[model samples]
Target: MSKLSISQAAKLKGVSTQTLRRWEAEGKLIPERTAGGHRRYDLAQLMGTKSELSFTVGYARVSSHDQKEDLLRQVEVIELFCASNGWQVEIIQDIGSGLNYSKKGLKRLINLITDHRVERLVLTHKDRLLRFGSELIFSLCEIFGTEVVIINRTEDSFFEEDLAEDVLEIITVFSARLYGSRSHKNKQLLQELKNVARQL
Candidate 1:
């Protein structure tokens, strides 16, 4: 069996290396690895499938200044999931709030999608890629005629699961820290936010 390196496979398919990595993480596609712990793609994996286009690409992201914190752990989880499932991925690291559309890594991902001329996407979760409401982002994906698969979505309730309540609690803690260190109305807002968060 002829094995192709990740880069060679990407170059052959004319997609970005990053996109392949994300697909791998989303449990959409997997690549065989070389003896040196390097990733290799099978040419047949990119062609001759029923879809007549066996090529696949993946994209992953996390938004936090402390990327090495929980974000890094999340990446590791996604990676293991992809590796076990025989998928390829593209990893993008950004150190900013997800609310920022102009994030450097995100922009690169967008460009790679357009530049590569593919129509498939993979994400860990909808919330990971989008923290805020993203009507515009959805529209862009539609315009690109892309089919996206969220490998690990919080809303996949049919799977008998949901975002861990602890995750939301951590978010509440961050919000509290941001506003609690204040006076007057700030304290009131903190209390209100806490109440709302508790309700969540």
Candidate 2:
């Protein structure tokens, strides 16, 4: 019959305060409101059966096929982190430009989020999710009551290289659109861009 504050409840449940908030939004575990409108949870109720918990998702990505080794490393890190937290996680991996939204793995991840099948989404780094517009996905997670866990929030060393590749992808797409995909001009423009990127 003990009532616990949000933080206390989160600690007792081995999850984050944000995850508890998300659960509240999903109507999975609505808490009582204090006189100050703060959330309070029943200790026994907070420790729900494992069957009621949703699974966690670990997402790992690298910018190109050549970085397959790095992708595996990312997966390993995510797995170890989840294991340390005693979280049951499914790892989704992608080997493509971070700017590409149509990656099969990414699509699957988004579908899982929209379906509310994921309790949490873990990532090695923010940019691994996307080079740009990652906030949009994070917002979707918020709406779907999915908590996002970034293992390393600090800037990564290969960020510049990945960014350069993403930039090249953008230029390639635009150039193709402007002068047909098979056009000589498009090919020449892309080559020049690639050469410039190489110099930097």
Candidate 3:
């Protein structure tokens, strides 16, 4: 029944100290406080509650249909990584711009997290989740006690290309919304944008 400080407990749990603090606030993982108001976690108690989570979720995304191979590669990588860790994973793949929030797979993943059915979320990279607003999702995960694992924290080789695509998507969506999707102005604007994107 060894007791550990918040940092030590967070390290042992593979989560951040901030996450531990949030969990404490949410009454999910309360710790005993010393006279000095330092939180102390019981190792035995932590270990005993380890099996409560449902399963790990592996999420893979590509910005377009042309990148389906890349999506598959991400899935394979996630599966192998989770297997090495003995994590039972369910792979969810998405084909859409990272800036698109309405993707079916992304919505499903959000639902699972919000429902507290996911123990962990495995990704090849953080941006694979979204070109923007990924942090909001991560914050949601923390609130729901879902651990996020990004296997590759390094800069992505295709980052520039993906960012360009997401930028194009944003422009296209906004152009259509402003000019009317079926209007000639919208079509011309989209074509011009695509041409410029291709030239770069």
Best model number under lDDT: 2
lDDT of 3 by residue, 81-191 (tens): 987876778999998888899999999999998987777899999899888899999999989888889999998766877877887877776774757657887678778
Clashing pairs in 3: none
Clash pairs of candidate 2? Answer: none
lDDT of 2 by residue, 1-200 (tens): 59999988876665667778777776889899999999989877877724254678999988888788888999999999998987878999988888899999999999998987787899989989888889999999988878899999999767978877787777876775756657787678778888887565
RMSD of each: 12.1, 3.7, 4.8
Best by TM-score: 2
What lDDT, from 0 to 1, does candidate 3 have? Answer: 0.82
Please list the residue runs of candidate 3 whose C-alpha ends up more than 4 Å from where it truly belongs after superposition: 1-53, 174-190
RMSD of 1: 12.1
Candidate 1 — number of clashing residue pairs? 18
Off by over 4 Å in 1: 1-60, 117-119, 155-200
Ten-residue stretch with the least lDDT total in model 1: 156-165
Residue 91 lDDT in model 1? 63
| Candidate 3, position 43, lDDT | 95
Q: Give the TM-score ranking, best first.
A: 2, 3, 1
lDDT of 1: 0.57
